[model samples]
Target: MSKRKKSTTAFKKANKFIPGGVNSPARAFSAVEMDPIFIEKGEGAYLYDIDGNQYLEYVNSWGPMILGYNPPQVIEELEKQLQLGTSFGAPTEVETEIAELITEFYPAVDKVRMVNSGTEATMSAIRLARGYTGRDKIVKLEGCYHGHGDSLLVDAGSGLATLGIKGSPGVTENTARETIVAPYNDQKAVAEIFNKYGSEIAGIILEPVTGNMGVIAPQRGYLEFLREITYKNGSLLIFDEVMTGFRLSRGGAQELYAIEPDLSTFGKIIGGGMPVGAYAGKKEIMDYVAPLGPVYQAGTLSGNPMAMQAGLTTLKALKKEDVYLELEKKGQKLEAGIKKNIEELNFPAYFNRVGSMFTLFFTDKEVQNYQDVKECDLDLFAAYFKEMINQGIYLPPSQFEANFISLALTDSDLDKTITANYKALNKLKAEL
Candidate 1:
């Protein structure tokens, strides 16, 4: 086992003040049957834990470090902005600059409003949808997590799936009723829900390409089917692109799939790893937000100058033609390596990949939905996770979470990761 004495001590101390010794429940490592490692710092493609162990990071701060940690350009921009000030609680030119950049990239977004996190982005988008449609209920996929917002917390994947909780404790039954849950990639289930509650539904929200349920992609024409149904129903189609935006492509899944949503939520790479998020769409719907329309949603830290500077720098860097192509090459390389290992080991594992996000499920069956993901062998994944960490690769602690790839990782780093994966799987097989 790796020497995690300092991490262990830090975790113990942290629990006295911070619940579960972590700010996010996903970081608690409860699903992996281990204590969380305390990170001291991160650099390009690697994290240094408090124990002084270096790990090739696959989590990438849960998908925002697309250019990897502390990219010189982003940091330089942030430093320059820091001298100016942090939060204005008002507005800045940088916000307009970033907003214009976002609208330029995403064809679906005619206008956008910034928020502090993915949760706020998703929550605000849903509210806007409801207000625009004059409906109260929303439809969400069973395992497609938007965030921790009360309306979205039901049947959420990611940390909720990791911890085996269906819905949170505090959400009222009435609130749960308003948010309908349907199986992902199941057009029939969605159709059935809409048929029953079509008039009441404000919108249908989903991860365009699911990362929360471990990188499941939409089935053929699945997105088109959704677009058709929502249009027919006179309801809004909301794409919770918090994970997919800018990561999938410059225009995100909407551009990749050639389907436009009425409203879309974005985070992660949009903020360049800073705490920022946004909801945007056609002017008709976005105009429903206050200061323009009747719906009221505001944030004290929305479009903070520091986050705007970092995001602007990151987005500008992403505009380069070769960035995503290079990412695709790296993703394909890593996917190929993992698939080769799985085949050689004859392990009952399946891999899913889209652009730079991927996941390895401990199941022989092809995963298409939450029920399919539930069939994965959690025990095997836990063993593999422990072995990988021991081999100096840091992955997401939960089997249900997607691992991200960053531009900072070299071919050598990928090779090392593949080698570590091979050894880890081999060790697990030997133990069995």
Candidate 2:
């Protein structure tokens, strides 16, 4: 590890032109009470910063690099596409091929439309839901974070949670009014909402296994109840798998949990680290979008050739390899080590894990919902973040986000992380 002199200097220069010296608020590292480090490049399981420091990174580009940085297969395809050219702004064969792969992997999706980011996928999906169902009101679980779209941002987790914003100011009262917010895993709240507004609600959207509120899993019978309730209410069920897609399993959280949603939005691994996103569902609902139906949506950079090539190559590799099995072993190993650390240190915080996604909350109380997650010790987490980073381990700066494990990580990397975590926690204990 080295001093962050270069990153500090860069931030000072950038502040003159950029708001807060960063494009995204999370990148500002405000949640950790620190300035962001400028990364030079990523290779294997590590990130190289501008200050000549290397970190065994756990953020994994916010859950996109499931195979880690610069996988050879994805790189090769990107290079091939580079020679062919970049964006054509028209239909491409590679686009259809990649869309076919998504439909094949997801049992609920018969058609899909590619977009530039997860926000676009989610925003369009909601519009399609309202258009097809002919209803205006939509229901979303608090802290699920479908995206920054006007209707879905209320009580959104992750970025908004990190910055301590309740909701964006510019959203109009009428738009916010249409979005009915409910706490995740609270079946009674959802049931009661349905009782009052079942017929008027356009759709119910949630994360099958939430990553935004630090990897909270749904309670027993919670998912089953949601599926049944939406079915009875004549409302579409949408799964925002922007974080879980192609990371949890072959078919994402839906396959792992055996609950298929009416519409599923994807990002992360499907883009193979490129800028891409997709929204898919049954043919009837998907056809409700664009040329085939009345609803309209288009993007100039949609299905860029390079993105399709990278995503297709990555998906093919995932299908051929024992990726999920390896991830499970890796996840279990890290979980056991961290649990041991907590026990030895006599820190009774709750840990949540769903496959390779996990979070170590700085609270003794269990975190099953947004309210519980908010009860965590923010000061302690901020201190822990400093300790871990100083030890050359890169973790998400905020407690609201999940730490990911990629296939490129070896057992040595896991051991180093465990050791660093123990040392960090030990230091915190001493400070206490």
Candidate 3:
């Protein structure tokens, strides 16, 4: 590993023009108590910082690079599309092909409307729900981030938690009032809210397995309970799978849990590395979204050929069933290694993992919500992150975020990461 070098200069320069020096808030690195490392490029499971230090990547572009960065198949497809053209602001045959591919994996998505980002998909979905049901209020979990759309950003987590913002500045109290926040894993809270405002609630949205709050799994029966309550209350259900989709399975969290949401939003791998998002559901509900129905949403860059090709190629490469099995194995190995370390070191910490996503919290308490996450030792985590970075292991900058495993992470990569983690944990203990 090379010595730490100055690489945040560009970001510092960018801050003068861009808010917080980042187009996305999490990249600001305020949560980790360090300046953000400007990445020169990434290949597979490695990220090369602008300073020329290479580290085993665990962020995976905040959970999209499942096939790993710049897969050859996806690159080739993008090149092919670049030759043809980029955006037409009209329609292309590839759009329907991708739509068909999506519905095949997710039969619940009989019809889909592609958008440019998860925010757009979610925003459009919420609007469609209100239009179809003619209701106003929407319910969301306190720590599940659905993106930056004014409506769905009500009870967001991730960057919001990192930045310590109570909520966005522009959101009016009147708009905030339209969104009802409920605790995750609490069916009673959900049921009570639906009971109290059943008629007024247009929809309920959540991440099926929340990666935002350190990979919190849905409590057993939590998803079923929500589905039952939403149906009984005549409220639509929206699964914000921007993080969980494609990564969890080809069908996303819905397929894993076997729960069918009335509406679902997707991002990340769907666009490969480009900006893309999509929302799809039963034909009846989807038919309510645009030209066919009154709920209007449009984007000039929606269904851009380049983004489509990248997503399609990436999805096709992931079609090999072994990829997920490999991810599960790698995920389990990493979790087991951390568990062993915890036992040996007797650190006051516990781990939560589901599939290829995991988080190590510096606390003994079971982490089921954002409140539990608030109790972790941030000082220990900060020291641990520095140590890990020094050891050429790249982890998420915040304790509240989960680590991602990609197909490119071989057994050796897992071994290196585990060893580095052990050293980091010991170093943190010494520091304390």
Ranking according to lDDT, highest score first: 1, 2, 3
Which pairs, if any, clash in model 3?
A: none
Q: What value of lDDT does candidate 2 attain over all alpha carbons? A: 0.92
Q: What lDDT does the true structure give each of the candidates?
A: 0.93, 0.92, 0.87
- Give lDDT tens digits, candidate 2, residues 1-432: 679999999999989899999987778899889889999999999999999899999999999998999999899989999998999998999999989999898999999999999999999999999999999999999998987899988999999999999899988899999999999999999999999999999899999999988999988888889989999999999999999999999899999899999999999888899999999999999999989999899999999999889889988888967789999999999999999999999884678999999999999988999999999998999999999999999999999999999999999999999999899999998887
> How close to the true structure is residue 377 of candidate 3, measured as C-alpha lDDT?
86
Cα RMSD for candidate 3? 1.2
For model 3, the superposed segments whose C-alpha errors exceed 4 Å read none
Q: How many residue pairs clash (N, CA or C atoms closer than 3 angstroms) in each of the candidate models, in the order given?
A: 0, 0, 0
The local lDDT score (0 to 100) that residue 252 gets in candidate 3 is 88
Q: Give the C-alpha lDDT of model 1.
A: 0.93
lDDT of 1 by residue, 73-124 (tens): 9999989988988887887898899999999998889998999999999999
Residue pairs with backbone overlap in model 2: none
In Å, residue 383's CA in model 2 sits off its true spot by: 0.8
